[model samples]
Target: MRALLLTAVAVAVALPVIPAQTWSTTACGPAAVSVGDYRQYEGTGSGTTPFSFTVTVTTAPGCTATGSVAYATEHISTGPADITATSGTLTWTDSTDAKLVVVGVVRDGTPEPEEAFSLRLHTPQNLVITRDRGRGQIIDDDLPPVETGLDGGKICWRYESSAVEVGVHTNTPARAPITVHYRTVHTGSNPPGYYPVKDGIITIPTGSTRGTATIRLKTEPNLPDEQFYVEIFSPSAGTLGLSRVPITVKSKR
Candidate 1:
């Protein structure tokens, strides 16, 4: 009986081991999607210029993602005057992951305050949006120089020793020294000679909004109420306002 039991155990051990039926399932589905952030962009110079911004869509590894995304401008806030409009669209594909949109900016030939607007992403087909909105800034690069008539529009000089101040104004602060070329025109009063016009250029220090040019009148006894002109011209930057200035020298009684 013992020998028979041992033989049975040996037979059972010798039998080949059968592996459990293994089942594997393959994963099939759409890829995970996400959108990148769009930052601010700026444009310079005058006239119509093309400006563009980009939007990015990221897909999970090994993802066979396919869908379409749309972009448009929203919450557009223009300055006091209408400057320009923003417009564009973006689409997603397996081959391309990023897309760019171009917008038009109308740069008027005048100095104005900064303007701003925003862009929005919506109607995403199969992608997740990490950031849906981005802010855009349109910087005003138009800097113009305007000449303000003499401080008081006119200055009366009683004597040659008396001097009058003429001013030039700018719409924006000067980034660098601004020089204005000027000359004197004797419109009235002869003889005794006109006041010596020494400096032809008025240098406006950096960051200053205004600069002045001085003209001294010549003291004459019987000169028919002399009048002289201080004409401003050729500014380093921007346009000139009231280029010509008039000064009256009241004749001595």
Candidate 2:
């Protein structure tokens, strides 16, 4: 009988072939659904430094997306809210793959100017947020770099003087407008008309931290006991402290 029909077709090909039962959906049409968009984090002032934002979620293949994603902070007073977010609630099982939601920003070293905030995405059940909202920027880095000094070291001229007032101090407060440069040093008795001796420019005005450089001495009339020096060179924004300032000319009484 043809060997009993070839042993019954090899026992029906060794039987056993079953795999079709992966039903567990929460229903999410439109090719499964997706949500991703959060790119804007520029903060490193080191007040605790930490500015990160990445929110992404895409599910479909057997779906199991549970939700509760809510983030807040929009147009805050340009500062204060610190920032923090690692999970606002978003669980997924049998996921289609692609899930990451992290947002953290908390660096308050104090010193602001460029600031903006916005990252919103709320209440999503079966999952569907093709790009909620994202826009964050905190670039102020705590503006600290503006130091110049010479409030008083010495200044006494009265031998044909016309002006004398040297006081330039700035540690912070001049967001704009600055200029500093002065020269004149005869050491001691170089009498021939000394005062301002050429080279000057001290104009710091924007919020004013103090700036005054008015020197002009040359009375011409047998001068002695002279001692000159008013130095503070090249400074358009800071760093020049104690810049040498001493002027005493009293010999014409």
Candidate 3:
């Protein structure tokens, strides 16, 4: 997630009458030396490596002087390693820059009014959604009923709603909400167990996969399918369209 704004403002001279040149450098937060593990400036302004700065200059009708200002860069790791059994992935990052300005009135007389602005940058977002490919078939389409289930590794859905890390002009899209639906099919009398009825998959085609309604349900044989129509809608776009999966059953007696 990234955002940028070029704010144009009238340079206030701090109500002080100046005719020539003026220069001042105000430092901020020691100006972060590095980002997570990546250095920014390589110690260009700060003492440590990767140090960077934001320079601002204000000149009247005629002024000659250099401006020196400092800013900080902080990172809030995305897709942290602590989130437990979360439905989807979440990310956090601090990408805001500090705005420091040095003005020379560039006019008759007006107070600089302790001008201060905030500059923030965004870090890259990391979201992951996963689902297994259709391995063969659950029913097998054979006789004797399979009565078995397949494993669909970690199914996930990920998205971001904010863009503070990706920086400006970044195609890195934020995560979005996702929902799932499923169709269940079971034969024979029945059995008891935590069957692989409904689950979510993270990996998908593209776009935010959110649940708009319920998952669509249908039976192979319409007659016995019974209420065979369940509606499922995803608010966001994703790879998986169904959520619940049912295995077929067979009885000899």
**Overall lDDT per candidate, in order of appearance:** 0.58, 0.60, 0.22
Worst 10 residues of 1 by lDDT: 36-45
- Candidate 3 lDDT, tens digit per residue, 116-188? 1122222212211121111110111112111111222121111111111100110212132222333334343
Stretches of candidate 3 above 4 Å error?
1-189, 206-235, 238-247, 250-253
Winner by TM-score between candidate 3 and candidate 2: 2
The candidate that achieves the highest TM-score relative to the unseen native structure: 1
Question: Poorest 10 consecutive residues of model 3 by lDDT?
Answer: 161-170
At residue 47, what lDDT does model 1 achieve?
A: 48
- Give the Å error, residue 245, model 1: 34
lDDT of 1 by residue, 114-229 (tens): 56656677777766666776655555545343333334356464654566677777666665555677778866445533565744888777677788887765555555566677
Runs of candidate 2 with Cα error greater than 4 angstroms are 1-77, 80-142, 151-156, 167-174, 177-203, 206-210, 213-249
Better of 1 and 3 by lDDT: 1
Candidate 1: residue pairs that collide: 147-241
Of models 2 and 3, which has the larger lDDT? 2
